[model samples]
Target: MSFELRRATVEDLSFARELTSQNMLRYYIEFELPWQDHAFDVAWSERQNWLIVRDSVPVGYVSLSRDMRALYIRELQVAEAFHRQGAGSWAIDQVIDIARGERRPAIRLTVFENNPARSLYERKGLQVQGRDECFLRMQLDISTPVL
Candidate 1:
């Protein structure tokens, strides 16, 4: 399957937000966290977002941002029908490439402690750097040369 990423615009907000809510709502409820629509709306407007397209159809979206030190993955969500087909991994690889291209030292993200996606992030080379009550902070130190 050939995957392409297209920049997300205002027109894509509903799809992206719904996809994220579908994928994350369980975790939010399980962790006793509030699902804030306004916050997601603000992020959609602020972040660098992309839709993961396969055969011209969108299968998911990824939201990203960066600082001087690292690239941050704010959201990564694949439609349930498309899970296990490698879209998520492909997105992560793309994010890594973007970080490397920009000369960022690392990639960072936070995942709910029990979220299954944590294993996928681990497989892509992000290690848990710390944890609080509800989230695990993970980072991939790309500054180190890959052997």
Candidate 2:
């Protein structure tokens, strides 16, 4: 199956809310943080969010921000029905390509410490840069050959 990502606009807020509420509640539980509407509010305003579409239907979303130093992945989530289907991996590869094409030195993100997606990030060539109480920061150095 082919996948495409399109910029998500305010009209897509309900789509994002549905996906996040269904699939991402565990992350908040694991971190002992309460889910809040403001979380999505801030994300909607602050990040470049995209919907991952499969055959014209939205199945997932990824939010990212690019700064002079790095391309940061704010969030990545695919519907439970789409797990193990390579959509997430493909999305990450697309983001990596974006970083490389834009001449960014690295891609950076923080995964909740116990989130299983940490392993996926590692498999995609991101290294554990550091960890704090709530999250583990990871970085993939796109300027090097490892990617």
Candidate 3:
């Protein structure tokens, strides 16, 4: 499937908020994350949000941030209809490409400890870095070429 990433703007905030709300129940249950309206606002405003477009339609969105140390993935929500079609992987590959271009040492993200996506991330070479009560911190060192 052909897809592209577009930077999300203020116009896309409402759609993003709704989509995230609809799909975040699993994480909420697993991690006790609050589904507060302000939380979405914070993410929409602070992170580099990207709308995953396929054939001119928005299929999903991912929120990413980069600090001096690593590329931090804050959110990745693929519409249910588009799941299992590689949208998530494509989005992640985009982030990896950015990290490589910047020569960043690693990519980091927090996944709900029991979230199924953790296994997919592990398969993609991210290792468990640490964990707290609700989240598992995972890291992928990108300084070395991925084999």
Candidate 4:
């Protein structure tokens, strides 16, 4: 049940991409959005990413970016086999700590409207701040104590 976060490397690209596709393709289809593989590459290049490893195997990853106002979670995908075992929640807690350490005012992310992960985000204190046809923008203000 112990998990560790390791900085993702170039070699992790394929694994991250495939894990994301597996978890998200259904939503893409449901929303009628095109699956653009290059988008992952673009984000991977621009953002900071980490692999969630259990023992020695990678079970998921989280990608992040930062602005003066907040730390943004660009992507967080957990392999199906590891879901409900706390990998996702642990990642979020790590992100919260990162934001706190960086003195960011908040943490932000966009989740597909029906994605089950939304509940996990909500449980972690991120509230829905806005929404579009396909996504809900959520945020957790960490300027004050949140631990």
Candidate 5:
């Protein structure tokens, strides 16, 4: 699906919340207790945020926080139906591009332990930086993904 991403507005919150949580569940391949609010709160407290769209309809979401030299990506999620459709990659590309434009040091994000995207991140050169009960923080070198 063709789509575009703009800076998220307050109106995007409702949509972002759902997409973010649902994506977490899907990424982990679990839900029962994994989708709990506790999971989101951890990311939210970091001050990162996002909302993505496809063909004029919201299709994905994320949350990000920037510190001294790092772009902390809290969450990134595309609707289950949108998997392999480029929605998630599109959103991630935008974030990296924007960060590069700003000369950010590195990009960071926390993904569920079982998330398949970890492989994508590995190919993209994002290395494990830390971990929590629900997330494995990955860091990408801003100088170049190949570094």
Candidate 6:
């Protein structure tokens, strides 16, 4: 299936919210409806950091927000059927492309220590920059990876 990423518009909000809810329920065991409302509010309030699309049947969702000086990836989820494909990788690459387009310093995110996506992030150039007992503070520096 072919896919493309574009800025979210008002017309796409409902679809975005639907995709968000579906993915959240399937992948995020800690999901909450109120949080989804808050996220929708934040994402729609400022369209700078959210992208949602369905190449065919709504493959995934991702939300990135700027925090302090660093860009924080607030959420990313690929639909159950779309997992293990390149949907996520392309979405994340788009995030990096956005960062590059804006000339940002880095992208930072927190992930559950046991989550499988950590491996994907690591392979895609994200690293554990800091951490606590439960979560890892990962950062993707917008520079060439070390060889």
Q: Listing every candidate in turn, what is its Cα RMSD in Å to the true structure after a full C-alpha superposition?
A: 1.9, 2.4, 2.4, 1.9, 4.0, 4.1
Q: lDDT at 98 for candidate 5?
A: 73
Q: How would the candidate models be sorted by lDDT, starting from the highest?
A: 4, 1, 2, 3, 5, 6
Question: How much is 84 displaced in model 1, in angstroms?
Answer: 0.5
Greater lDDT among 2 and 6 belongs to 2
**Global lDDT of each candidate:** 0.94, 0.88, 0.87, 0.96, 0.73, 0.71
In model 3, the clashing pairs are none
Each candidate's TM vs. the true structure? 0.96, 0.92, 0.91, 0.96, 0.77, 0.72
Per-residue CA lDDT of candidate 6, range 36-59, in tens?
Answer: 566676665574534545654556
Preferred candidate (TM-score higher): 2 or 5: 2
lDDT, candidate 5, 96-140, per-residue tens:
887887778899887777879888777777899898877788998
Backbone steric clashes in candidate 6, count: 0
- For model 3, what is the alpha-carbon lDDT of residue 73? 88
Q: What is the lDDT of candidate 3?
A: 0.87
lDDT of 1 by residue, 117-138 (tens): 9999999999999998999999
Worst 10 residues of 1 by lDDT: 138-147
Candidate 4 lowest-lDDT run of ten: 138-147
Best by lDDT: 4
Off by over 4 Å in 3: 144-147
Clash count, one per candidate = 0, 0, 0, 0, 5, 0
53-119 per-residue lDDT for model 4 (tens digits): 9999999999999999899999999999999999999999999999999999999999999999999
Which sequence of candidate numbers ranks them by TM-score, best first? 4, 1, 2, 3, 5, 6
